[model samples]
Target: MTIESESDHILFLSRDLLDDIELQRLEADKLLLKCSRLARLSGTDEIKQWIKLEMEGYNGSKELSDHYMSRTGRWTNFAERKGYWGPLAQIEENIRVQKLRIDVSKVESLSGDGLIGAMRMNRDAQQALANGISSMVAIRSRVLNMLHTFVAGVYYERQFAKVAESTFEQYKKDVDALIAAHAGEVLEKLPSVVARLQEGNDEAVSQALTTCRRIIDSFADAIFPPQAGTYNLGGNDLSLDANKHQNRINVYVAERTDSKSRRTRIRQNLSNLYDRVSTGVHTDVTAEEAFSLFLNVYLFLGEILHLGVAQTKDSVMA
Candidate 1:
């Protein structure tokens, strides 16, 4: 294209004066090599052809010059206003630094540790769900049996305390045995469960607990289940860390709730619920089911409470 601007004309003359025939051939070869590199970088054949044509000085007519001027004007406006680059060295440097900052920020947000943290969180969540569910099943069974025996002993005697006292001792022993056998299993799965709980919503946690309750109730009915008795298992008063004995339980619940000892309080309510369910039933609910039920209850309650708190805060802010 014929250079119109004084500055462009000077640039063109200077370059032409420097271009010997052998140097022109070498420059053409360099352009061809650049075309290949651009094609690989851009992943397009059209850009390669455009580079080839531009390097070969394939101007068809005066109309082509007008067309080139129009395209150049568009690009020049964009480079000057929108910060692209061409022959202007200072403008190119400014664009380079601004682009560098944006690229660095993106990389910083997704470092290696960040990726690993996300992966570990996911793995932990899956493991927790599985273990919590299993524990629920076992706990359900143990609670049911304790309740059945307690009721049987009381129903056949006048002294409720005497009957309850012996039953309570046996209940504690049974619980200890059950914990001995299954506590490690639950603890092993806690890291993941804690992670999963951290991500759960109230509805999801409630649904999971509800599923465990339904499964346990169904299983209990199939075993030493309901009979003609006054079994009160509908109250939600389980105390989680009231006795301060369940440190692991506290940690899991706290992490999930993002609150201090909220999980413990939830566990207490869950325990009460279990006791009520098993109070008069003649069923063989397993310890695993009970633990799972407890976990579910804690998670569900925490989710609901969290949402309520958030809503309250928003309302206050408004």
Candidate 2:
């Protein structure tokens, strides 16, 4: 499949899955609220009073026990005094308390119609639904993060973080080699570039990429001497050529295998790198991606330098 098609496929898949997850999340949230309300409503005032008594460290009501044992419907022996008492009523209250216990216990297991006691609700289904919502939300978060980077066309940001640990070590070695081979003035500013590129901060990485771009431009200038100076000035103002940068890149591309060469690939990569470098310096660009782009530029510069050296040797021999 083409890259465009693949990207569209992934985008659609991510969006659809995220929509389903959001639906589940909403359902779970609604169920949770319903359960809470039911738990509250199911608790009778008497039950709350009983629970409050326990919460307040009251062992039990002594007067009720005394009145119950005496088989009196009054709070005391004084005929003029009256207080509520009924063995049947207390029995009925106990039954209601037991029913309340069952109703409250079902809160966690409640789902479908059982949420409202319309039908039996499977506890496992309820748990799975809740868990699925959580799992999907986490996945959705990750997918959206990647999609944001992808949609922005910042390919490196989505890719660099997923690079293997061993690959990073290899890249680190390449950086060290580049430093060692081009020490002194050629790479005087590059000692910390690799380190900064590896930082978690995007700003630092963008700075490093910018540094690499400058180094590449300077190296290109050194390799391809400007033709403007070669022409006689004739006492007229010697205006520097505006297309010198493009001319240098064209010269570099011309030295390689003709139409069959990967020169186009090089140019495209360089263009993307340049765009990203500009964005990195001026706006927010993920550091890892900036570093990845830096690696591409570094490799391209190395090839350009190698080719230039070869051509110089051939001319010397001639």
Candidate 3:
């Protein structure tokens, strides 16, 4: 319902936006195909009313320019000051005037490639249709890319939450620091998503990515959070039961028995899980691969918890 992250908002909105743009492009293609069909039926041997028909459709097609122009209306201020208005108006007027000039027969009079060109559609009408479609496509690609980045970041955080919150804070202070750094990276990426919505322009996407990368690069303090720790001998620390403190099947298993070898294996398992997920975070992995990794991390955190409990029991026995 309420999407908190701006990037997430864009990512979610993009699904519908792409559908609408693609639908418009399909409509434009159909309109052009109709023009081509009329051209063929009339024959290039003599000028027909195809051009007049196309101009009429261009004016009548409510789907063509309205959405794109409305979205990019703010940019029109720059487009107009740079003298784009004259060319834009000229294209509109040419299409408009052709509707009344049915008897002019200018397109049919032309021979060779000129005639071939008219057969496709009126040149201006073809261009207008193409521009509208291309602009929509460009926006779609950028939005899709933004969504990809946001999804990947979410994967990292979810995976991290499974691992980082598995151990007590006082026992593994460095691990908590690592989780804090990761939280900072995730937060840094969220604020710029508002700017992304203002204009889905190239510059906006680039700026958002750059900001996120800068924060990611700053996380040099710790790479991996520890999974196992002893009791909080120093009672000054806060005891917020995180993912680390809870959901540990290993800890439950360890409390039942005194076997030391199985506990060592649990410690090794936790270490292997951390290494695997750390690599996953720093590299490219498909969605399937990422999800598999998240499950693996979840299971391994439980093993880490078990190892921590076993070690604490052994220390008490000694």
Give lDDT tens digits, candidate 1, residues 1-318: 686654344334334323422243333344344334424443245444433433443333434433432433322342243211122222223344544544443423344656877656655665554454343333323322332333233233423444676786875555434433433333233344344334465433444344444433332232222334232222433233223222323333443454535555665765565554344134443344434555554344334334445655777999
- Which prediction has the highest TM-score against the true structure? 2
Compared with the true structure, what per-residue lDDT tens digits does model 3 show for residues 1-318? Answer: 576665444434433334434454334334334333433442242212322322332232333333323332312343343211222223444444544453343354566766776755666665555564454444334433433343344445544553565544443454333334444453344446445424555555444434433333222111222244443312423232333322233344345456668655654665465455445445544444434544444344334434445666888999
- TM-score order of candidates, best first? 2, 3, 1
Q: Cα RMSD to native, each candidate?
A: 33.6, 21.0, 20.1
Q: Name the best candidate (by lDDT).
A: 2
How do all models score by TM-score?
A: 0.17, 0.37, 0.22
lDDT of each: 0.40, 0.49, 0.41
Model 2 clashing-pair count: 0
Stretches off by above 4 angstroms in model 1 are: 1-29, 59-69, 72-318
Q: Which stretches of candidate 3 lie over 4 Å from their true place?
A: 1-117, 120-123, 167-318
Q: On a 0 to 100 scale, what is the lDDT of residue 159 in model 3?
A: 42
Order the candidate numbers by lDDT, best to worst.
2, 3, 1
